[model samples]
Target chain A: MAILTGVSMQNRRPLTGWGRTNATVAEVIEVPNHEVAAAVKEAGPRGALVRGLGRSYGDAAQNAGGLVLRLLGSAHQAVLDPSLATVTVPAGVNLDELLRVLVPRGFFVPVTPGTRFVTIGGAIASDIHGKNHHVEGSFGNHVRALTLLLADGSTVVIGPQQQPELFWATIGGMGLTGVILDATVGLLPIETSRMSVDTTRIPDLDALFSAMSDGDDDFRYSVAWIDPQAKGRHLGRSVLGRGDHARLDQLGPKELLSPLAYGPKQLASVPPLVPPMGVINHATVAAFNEVWYRKAPLHREGELKGIAGFFHPLDMVSRWNRVYGSSGMVQYQFVVPFGEEEAMRTVIERLSVSGAASFLAVLKRFGAGNDSPLSFPAPGWTLALDVPGSARGLADLLHGLDRLVLDAGGRHYFAKDGRTTAAAIRQGYPRLEEWKAVRDSVDPEHVWQSDLSRRLGLTD
Target chain B: MDNALGEPQTILLLGGTSDIGLAIVREVLSPGARTVVLACRNVEKGELAAAGLRHGGLAVHVVHFNGSDTASHEQVIADVVAQHGDIDLAILAFAQLGDGAVTSKDVQAASEIAHVNFTGTVSATIAVANRMRGQGHGAIVMLSSVAGERVRAANPVYGGTKAGIDGFAQGLGDALAADGVHMMVVRPGFVHSAMTQGLKAAPFSTTPEQVAAVTAKGLRAGRRTVWAPGILRYVFSALRHVPGPVWRRLPLG
Candidate 1:
């Protein structure tokens, strides 16, 4: 596989998601812009899926016993029109790569996840949501139009107004409907690359809930980092950060000189090799959470910070996932309806009592969901956590949580979920049948497939 | 695909009537919806075993398979894969304990044991491994034994065949690793199953359930070899280096 041929097909290469769980092998091929249709035509029985940066936490990007295509798309060639406020970029262009090119041009991606290493194709496939999801909706909302490679080797231009059904289905279809070639995404205009921020460390779940529910509407971007192990009176203790783009007038004389400068620093990178047992176990996570909680400011406002510092702090240390070691990690993200705040509280309390060592647990509110049935976000309270993949009784704990989440009319995020069942997905997504109708209409023979799709019964 | 936690969706058990094989399947599929294909020589017994497993959420398909029939291995595997999409896990537990002392002087008896344990296992495993390799990812659990670690004088025929099969499985595992197929060789000291019903229990003897539990852990951890009762791994490690003359004098018999 290290040696490349003219066709660029690496046979039987093992792949895993960012979580590093459930590794599978596929024949990875670098399908060029023109050959995407050809790859679709020649995709064999197991079919084909387009992988981008391997950012999705689960098997959404992996096609077991099939072809995985990496399209050659670059952000350097992006077409940015400040007038219409849109950028037509290749699907393989990562958010960071695009940000480097676009931020200097006085524009920002409408939505970005915790990590900026995600591809445009992956962002749309997962319908990835961010802190701004409560105000701007998910990534699919800003996509004005997208070019797709269908099952029969035919390409189609789909948009919200044109072929909206197929368009939305492809949005969060987990790459089951078809492969996205490129997208014409609407961008958000910004005055500077710096963020004007506010930070608050709430003492308990009750106070944190009321604070978030009250203050979330005021900021364009808002999120809270909850310490999952904090229990009793201190249950769900968290630090909330809310922010928006810093205005030119907000910057000082020195900062105003190069207010649009976008040089995000990489302070350190985690070494590739780590201990077999991993460094992120219960004791270590508990200690880290305690120190992190004590370190956040009691209350602060309008603190000017770099965009990456505010959004992608974890991205500063590359290969950070290696901390989870060979056993890898399991990420569980589910959103319960607004009224079911009790259920969300119960999930937090249970994890606190169980002492399962969930790291970087965050809680947020999502705005109204779009037409995409498989889309993860909704008008609710969403909680996401990452735990040790090899933790004892972790599955049973998550399975129990699944019942509570589903009972509360909540749904799990496909991009972040690595261990949920199809039954749970069936309960979460009421409009799943409708989405399947559209997907099947396009992929009658079911050419598009993935391990996640099969596990969750989204496709064969 | 094995779920993110490495729980398989479909399982193919070559020895349908094996307690350890069924136990491993039970541990993995407990109360969860999954498919299990039981391929064994005895259809009636396999059905009975399948019935026991059906209490939990499982689709148990009892298929006919003759371990001694080397020529039929390929077709049997193909039939299973054709009926069931692809096997996520395959358990090769079909084995023969030759009657009496075959390694002493009876060449015919020795051949009978080798025919199934060594020869049949090699053919059948190759058939399944090939399919698993094509299927991209799979886990194979071969029920080798502690006796195979060093062929014992008390049960030389059974030990001899296991020794050969164990070596073959290890070699096959290395080749299959590049194809995303994992192989786990289970070496159990003794098991109080129907196969060893009347035998005197050894000090570190284990039940089928114990073996199955270890098998499940090994598969989850992607381990190449697993020892039942856990301590057998360390015990065998030390025993592997023991002087032959001193080892033979220890009252193992």
Candidate 2:
């Protein structure tokens, strides 16, 4: 076996999550093939962690002063098993690339996050969920098998049926167990890339919650945009949107010729230069929220919209995060169980009255969580908001929200987290010990480590 | 490589330990700027500053740079480029602010101030401009001052040096506009930094962070010049046109 060390192309660079909040320096090594096992074995005491597209909103992919293997450079083709409705793809392949190939073939990823920019490895590691999560579980549920490079420099094929303990641990393990080289994922068949969307305006928090609880099951996907600045009687007023893949008969004659064609185009791009303190302040966000709410139709149904328009509207603009400016922004996402409606209501009410400025506030109903110990979604309400990190009293506000969530039998999502505490993680995941035990057996030396694992004491 | 937030990946700080320079660096750090080269005459101080930024998870590189050493200015910029590739932004923030006594009576002090603040700035600016011009895209932020708008008799020599650099930076900005290189001249009122620790607070006095905020804002807007605290621009505009007798008697000094 050829040991490829020292002579490889490597540079010490800073790496940050999609949030662009906390950045750390690491030696990034570009792994061009499945022989990444050699690089993993040769990594120094700090060990090595794999990164794909750097889409995680936290330090999950960053390893300070250690080796970071960028697996995207590894060229591996995606093979489609047409009859089985499954596609085997390299871990480096991103969902956008996979979609380009699968969509034309009349299939779509079983699970896709808000943005298709995420790699398959990153999606599985984070166990990402989407709008359809209420109907189709997380990305981990559709994964049939994966080729993970163990800490001992040995490649192992693991699945839900084979080494289920390790498989579950690695699903939401944040790349601690091993590096995923490729995965076989089940795909969903689609008649067209367009979605039949329905939108409605809900007056208040009570109405919004009841509407989702009562009607969300009828649609395959559902989400709501809540106005955090709305107070008093208007508090939690939202524009609820529900969508499902449009059938052949649903399309007009003009769209029928190429119903299955999937092409997501960038309409505009945010300028690279960002002003200090950012452009999204309390006033701007409130104004934007109001305009967005009023502009949405009170009731609209069966509107045929492009896949990008229906899902991931923000993805149409490249570098849109720049709108937050140099201070960056924070995305707080948490899930509270079904019975904790009161707790969830209290949190939302507090945020609304606290004068906190959140640009994107989304509320979704999660159906059920998979077997992954740290999976974020549960059969309840999950609220996500993008608040400027520079906002005054943000830390205290989020800390208080964390306490509320924990008390309500809720936990924060690790993929969208940057500042959660170790004690919080412990209280959140009851099966953390079980996941760690399986991790220890596979990599007793803890060779696969990241800054996130270190911060949360997951390596110990 | 730009992060999702579009912040620069690399920055070069000419005056590594300057309060305003460090402040700007901190602001950009949040937007995912990773590599920083702190070039200063004081290696120990530069290393100390670099260490602080490193603690914040940035990759900091310290280099020996004497602002007054005009001959070595080109080499300093070349070295940084060779080591870190094209610098996304280069900050020219090295200057000497002499007191009243030195400005009026001390020839040696006045000469030293002129050499460091004006001539040195010219040297560094030219070197950075040449490299950025070759790269086809880069931003340079020059820290000018409100005192330069109209030299006050209170500190003639210090104000004179600033006046010289401010004019040069503005002209250079015009020259580089077509080359895809941008130059932003920030004119800030008295800033409460180590440089002006005991000085009386001037009208519209600001902090290094505030000045940094204005500079970042200006860079974003592609403005050729900006005023820290912003109100100072109106103040200076009206003050600049005042008769010499009236301006000298205003007690601004």
Candidate 3:
């Protein structure tokens, strides 16, 4: 096993996810290589867990009083298989790094989350789905095979055909089954790192849903930025954006020179000084929502944009989460199966009327659910919002949403969950017991654990 | 990291279970705070408080920290810094509010109060300042009281301790200003918190939430010293000039 060189070890290091909520302390060891198995074995009674770019947005990445393995320094390289359109790389390699390397080679990750900072391990662990979920299933569907380091110091190669149950469990398993070391992931071949986007401003919930249902099949990726503050007749008004990977012929003469060049730059960064109250109050969010809504073209087609511009606009501003002020923001993401549009609409109405002040509320259509029991998406409507953590009566409001989601036979995404109750989990995931059984079979000792796992009673 | 509105990503609360501390924390939580360290005398109580405040994606951690443990003040500060790097804000809201009768007559009681409210605070402030100075950026908020401005005969012992901490905090604030570390000394007038729940409501009394709001506003405005109700500033200024004989006769004592 290769030892992690230049990796620092710190005792009682405090950790939080991207959402900046539910902070916990752990002994963090930066695993530099496959030696992570040895490090896990050295963890005390609290056990050991792995953490990647820490983008789970909740306690999923945090292990309180336990040993946390940071894989940022883990020594693994991306090996591109151009012929097969697959890349076998270390799970610690983040999407941003992979994209930078792969895009020029006419290849892109099959699926990507909202941001590119997430590590491949985190993406697979959470089984992240992106705008293309309407067309492609999820990140898990693209994996060829993966090497998982299980408890009791053993490693196994698993895929759909090889150890199917454990393989599916590991996807969106929140890292409870084992540590994902490396994986061969199938990539999508693209001619350019640009998107041919179509923009439309829909007036209301009914119209937006109708438009999506009728036209979503025409595009590979589709999403809508809903104005949560919109009320009454204008309720659920959204700016719909649909796009597909741009081809070489679609580029202009200037762009055609280096069509695959990937340059995601930071335009601005939020400083590290939070004011007493955040800048994103009701008034500011309302105004921002209105401006953003108005800024979209009533109907525009064939608008070319960079991958970062279309997929991860927020990435342009590093530490943008600070905009919410010291009170961190809550990302509420729930998906109700198809034919449950009424429940989804009711939740949106509640959020709007409650004055939750979420400027980044989005609605997207999920194509279908995968075998991963805990995977967040299904063939349904998914709405995600960033609510200020300090909002008064937020917990009650979210709990209410959770109840609605559960009743609709929907579920909240564990990767973005912070305050979900155990009862909600039981109601949301009908196959949770099966997933738990598979997990227990692999790690009966419960070596892999996190604050989220403990909170949701996933670990006994 | 501070957001567009200048909200800190991390906060350190010395009196983790204190109502005032929690209120200030909640106020900060609205903007985009990421990590919170609740250091209190009772870890269990801190944990309970943490659970209540845990929402959104905020991460809350509780550690055993007794304000009266002057000998361990440095270690506590070190441990906090070591665990959580570059604490954006460190709130020294821990203090002992002894009974007026017991504090006035009992040497041990008065010593305990003085030790926790003044000596302990002083030691902790020094340790925090040193760490902040090294980090080159941090803020420290000390919870002082109006009683410190003009020590009244009613609770002279408690007032004396507050007075000592008030002066020490101000001096420390001035010293830290040069090091890019801000020190905010909050002079609230009889805050209605768990500590003062049973006591008579003093003039210009405020709630922990009100104090927290004012403290947050003060932090944003970059004010070194702030009075909770704002009116208390003028009231205290006028009362400070009152003749000692006349002050003693006032019913406030």
Q: What is the TM-score of chain B alone in each candidate?
A: 0.95, 0.95, 0.96
State the local distance difference test value for candidate 1: 0.88
Across B76-146, the per-residue lDDT of candidate 2 in tens digits comes to 99999887765778999988787877667888888888899999999999999988655445689999999
Tens digits of lDDT, candidate 1, B57-116 = 468999999999999999999998888777889999988765545455688777877888
A288 Cα displacement, candidate 2 (Å): 0.8
lDDT of 3 by residue, B1-253 (tens): 3321335667999989999989998886642366799999889889999999888667799988887777898898888777755577899999878888888999988888888888888888888888766544567999999989998777788899999999988887897665557789999998887898778888888999999999988886568999989999999889999998888787772
- Regions of candidate 1 where Cα sits further than 4 Å from its true position: A1-10, B30-33, B55-57, B102-107, B241-249
Clashing pairs in 2: none
Off by over 4 Å in 2: A1-10, A73-76, B1-253
lDDT of each: 0.88, 0.83, 0.84
Which of 1 and 2 is ahead in DockQ? 1
Provide the lDDT at B175 for model 1.
Answer: 92
The candidates' DockQ values read: 0.68, 0.03, 0.06
Leading candidate by DockQ: 1
For residue A310, give model 3's deviation from the true position in Å. 2.5
